[model samples]
Target: MTRKKYSKEFKLDAIALVLEQGYSRSEAARSLDINANMLGRWIKEHQAQDDQAFRGNGKLTEEQAEIRKLKEQVRRLEMEKEILKKATVFFAKETK
Candidate 1:
């Protein structure tokens, strides 16, 4: 049999039906016109993302604007260092 593929949102909602509305996995799969195994896989994938969503230092938030600013400063400093090294090398070659 040729199988049809569903969108990410469709898979997420199918998984949610079983988890949030207390539907049986089989029932949810049937109602959504998807395979039970696929629904189970989507649930596991969702749980994994939710678990690691905040594994970082959380410097991406508006409250961490200072942290973001410091990172940009460090990047600029590194670029400046590279430019200085190239200039020093060019000057040394010309003097020789």
Candidate 2:
């Protein structure tokens, strides 16, 4: 079965039920029809990340985006280096 995707706002609301509304984790999860363990994890994430919590798909933080771009650039540079190495070997053979 495909996993269900929760929106960031939904997650925040769920977290609020526990923090602001004083609902126990199990009670919140049961009332919301979600797993208690999942609710616990969401609470932890909310505590740690605050505003940055529950970033949905394709929405990366600035640091993560920069890292992704740098990794792509490194891969492209490595491929170019390999092509240049092959070209150098080809020219050296032709000169002999």
Candidate 3:
């Protein structure tokens, strides 16, 4: 079965039920029809990351975005380096 995807707002609301509304994790999860363990994990993440919590698909934290950009740049540079190396070898052979 495909896993269900929860929106960031839905996760925040679920966390609010436990943190702000004083609902037990099990109670909140049952009322929302989600897994209790999942609710507990959400609460932990909300407490830990606060504003950064529940970054949905295709959303990255600033640091993560930077890292992704750097990785792409490195890949492009590596490809360029390989092309330059092949060109150098070709020129060296022609000069021999």
Candidate 4:
């Protein structure tokens, strides 16, 4: 069977059902037709990140996004520095 993907809202609702609604994890999972283990994991994730939980596919958390952007900028600057170094070496040779 193909795996199912739940939205952030759905996961949050499921967690709320167990936490705020005082439903047992197994009860919530059975009522939602999802695995108990899945519900437990969702609860943990929701508790860990609260409003920032379940960012979905291809989406990054704020820290992750900032780190990715910084890494890309560092790569670009390194490439530019390498090119400049090569140009300086070539110019020095030409002046000899």
Candidate 5:
């Protein structure tokens, strides 16, 4: 068996292809010329880091923290809007 040499850019791109582009892990590994297992591990690690960073538990920038908070707020507001629309329809029907 031979050893594989992977660069940071290659690993990052492979992970992105598998994740962002929705490529299969095996396909990403084949395209990157790395082992599928290695690619999977990298993906898991990358996701962990991202999750932590988004939550501000990891070493993320202030901008990232703000973005994460804003995204959460948007989700909450959307849900509230949906609930309000449903309630309005229900009340309007009852009053009819």
Candidate 6:
């Protein structure tokens, strides 16, 4: 069977049925014709992302993208700093 893809809005509405409408996960899943575990996973993803939930493939939420960029920058800076420190030590020994 081909895997089904759910739209972000559909996932959000399903989550709301459980969260805002106070339906149990199983009930919501049954009503939506989805697995209870799938509904639960959707709820977890929705809670983790809030408005950013269910961004499509190859996309990162703004906060997550910024964090990844910052981490890369930090790693680059740290490597540069390490190289400079080694260069300084090498020069000092050469000057001795």
Instruction: Point to the candidate with the largest lDDT.
Output: 2
Write down the TM-score for model 4. 0.87
Candidate 3 lDDT over 25-93, as tens digits, reads 999999999999999999899899889988888899899999999999999999999999999999999
Q: In candidate 6, residue 91 scores what lDDT? A: 100
Against the true structure, whose TM-score is highest?
3
Candidate order (TM-score): 3, 2, 4, 6, 1, 5
| C-alpha root-mean-square deviation, each candidate | 6.7, 1.3, 1.1, 1.5, 13.0, 4.1
Q: What does the lDDT read for residue 57 in candidate 2?
A: 81
Task: Show where candidate 6 strays beyond 4 Å.
Answer: 63-96
Clashing pairs in 1: none
Worst 10 residues of 4 by lDDT: 49-58
lDDT of 4 by residue, 1-96 (tens): 999999888988898898899999999999999999999998888889887789888888888999999999999999999999999999999999
Worst 10 residues of 2 by lDDT: 50-59
User: Mind giving the per-residue lDDT tens digits that candidate 5 earns over 3-44?
Assistant: 656655676788889888999999888876778998888788
- Once fitted onto the true fold, the runs of candidate 5 whose alpha carbons sit more than 4 angstroms away are 51-96
Clashes of each: 0, 0, 0, 0, 0, 0
For residues 1-96, write the lDDT of model 2, one tens digit per residue.
999999988999999999999999999999999999999999999999988889888999999999999999999999999999999999999999
lDDT tens per residue, model 6, 1-96:
999999988998998898999999999999999999999998898888677778889788787799999999999999999999999999999999
Candidate 1 residues 38-88, lDDT tens each? 788778877887633233444355546877789999999999999999999
Clashing residue pairs for model 5: none
TM-score, cand. 2: 0.88
Better model by lDDT: candidate 4 vs candidate 5 = 4
The local distance difference test score of each candidate is: 0.78, 0.96, 0.94, 0.92, 0.79, 0.91
